[model samples]
Target: MPQETFTLQIRQIRLETDDVLSFELASPTQNPLPVAPAGAHLELHLPGALQRSYSLLDEGLGGCYRIAVKREPQSRGGSAWLHSQARVGQTLQAQAPRNDFALNEHAPESILIAGGIGITPLLAMARRLNRLGHRWSLHYAAPSPDRMAYRDCLQALAADGHGSLHTYCSSEDRRLDIAAVVRASGPQAHLYCCGPAGLIDDFITATQDRPPERVHYERFAARHAASTEGGYEALLARSGKTVKVSAGRTLLDAILDAGVDIPYACSQGVCGTCRTRVISGTPDHRDECLTEAERQSNEAIIPCCSGALSSTLVLDL
Candidate 1:
């Protein structure tokens, strides 16, 4: 099946932070925008073939989707254009919502780690957990107090007794101790991390010994044109085909570039459209679409964002 294309109109824009703007997008033709769960993202097709994926901060029954965009210091035209040129009532093109990060409703508790603008998806998870009367905690880090987005909402969640919110500001000489946080979590608590590559790497290191089923993460595509998660060899079984995916390259991109056809929609591991079988090797499971059981089995891999935890992944291609 093909993904749906939508004509979205920017209905409103709210200033989230000094550098962040939250846009309220709705379909201009009264067509309902795709409903997305917490931790979902939508790809906005902008001018000059500039397509960028944004975390869906709010998905309402009123056919409106809210997403936050932070003006990157480098400004590669996606966030910069949204900040400068995107206007209310102007129509834009986008894909249906997809999620690479999703909350685990079944876990006894959730431990969320976020850095900078990475709060977008985690905020949604906090709200969902609150709505469901679940216990959760958020460890958020930012440059300064003012730089944190949705601080009021997170504080409100704390006030409402939905979750605990902890802030660590680097400017104040405070930092989130990944090891300490992981060490403090209960056994059944699922851990989720989405932030800068460095933060993610630290989180992974701290939780490496934990059950693979209990850890969930999403890649932050704002930086790192290739995967910063390291790289390895992908050996296709049938033709004995092999591609050495570099530290900066993704398995999906490398496979496609090799003219090896693999159907994939959202290259961020949300859609589950590109799930491939793994005959051998441990996969660095980073997709929300797969369950804990699936990950524990280590029988499949979402090649888009996921990589080989082992040096070589034997694909049953």
Candidate 2:
């Protein structure tokens, strides 16, 4: 089915912390919104073509969508705009919820690890697991207690014995040992992590020996590494055009320069929106969204941040 768009009115805006704020959006006509499962996110279509993806924090809340946004000092304007211009009475356009970091609900035991603003999605997972009486634990790490967004709710979950909550505060000299936490979760438990690249990389490295399917993660941003050497040629099959993708220029930009239209959001390679079918060619596969199996298949490529390995490539588009 094609994705749907809706206009929602901001009913409430509550500050979760010094830098984070939670916005509750509801249908303007008081109609029920689409039901979004835990770990789902919505793409907000802000003014000036500034689109940003935010995770929904509503685990059990009904008929509305809740999202927490953290203001980033070095933001590309999305967070800053929301923090400064968004108001309770304002209406915003947003895409329906989509889940790229879905939880494995059938797992007997689950382990959740979060860092900073990454806790938004995990918080919903924790709530669902607790309500369903599933065995789970959460480990949240932040710079300090004042920076943690949902401290009170997490504490209440721990107090109720629904799940164990372990917090690490860098100001208090506490460290989150990724290896220790992964090892303690046991081999059969499913692990979900969302955080900074360094933390996610550490967890991935620590769990390399474990079953790959048992470990899941979501990254907030793309890892900007040194580009590969040389330029490549991309053949747009549908457009009957050939475009030169320079080493400094991304494939998506090259294609667009050739007068081809492709849909994309979060050009950082974290979102799978720019995923395009590869009729033929070897993709360099720099994107963080695709799984190992998907990368190995070479059936699709995320053009926004990924490049081609072969000199000449063919794209379905």
lDDT of all predictions, in order shown?
0.83, 0.86
For each predicted model, how many residue pairs clash, with residues at least 3 apart or on different chains? 1, 0
Pick the lDDT winner: 2
TM-scores of all candidate predictions against the true structure: 0.75, 0.92
How far off is residue 29 in model 1, in Å? Answer: 3.2
> Can you write out model 2's per-residue Cα lDDT over 1-317, one digit (the tens) per residue?
12557888998999999999999988898876777888988888888877788888865277788899999999888899999999998998887777888988889889999999999999999888887878889999999999999989988876777689999999999989989998888779999999999989998998898898899899998886423443899999988999988767888888878878786667788878778999998998888889989999999999888888889779987
Model 2 weakest 10-residue run by lDDT: 222-231
Task: Tell me which residue pairs clash in candidate 2.
Answer: none
RMSD of each: 5.5, 2.2
Q: After superposition, how far is residue 99 of candidate 1 from its true place, in Å?
A: 1.8
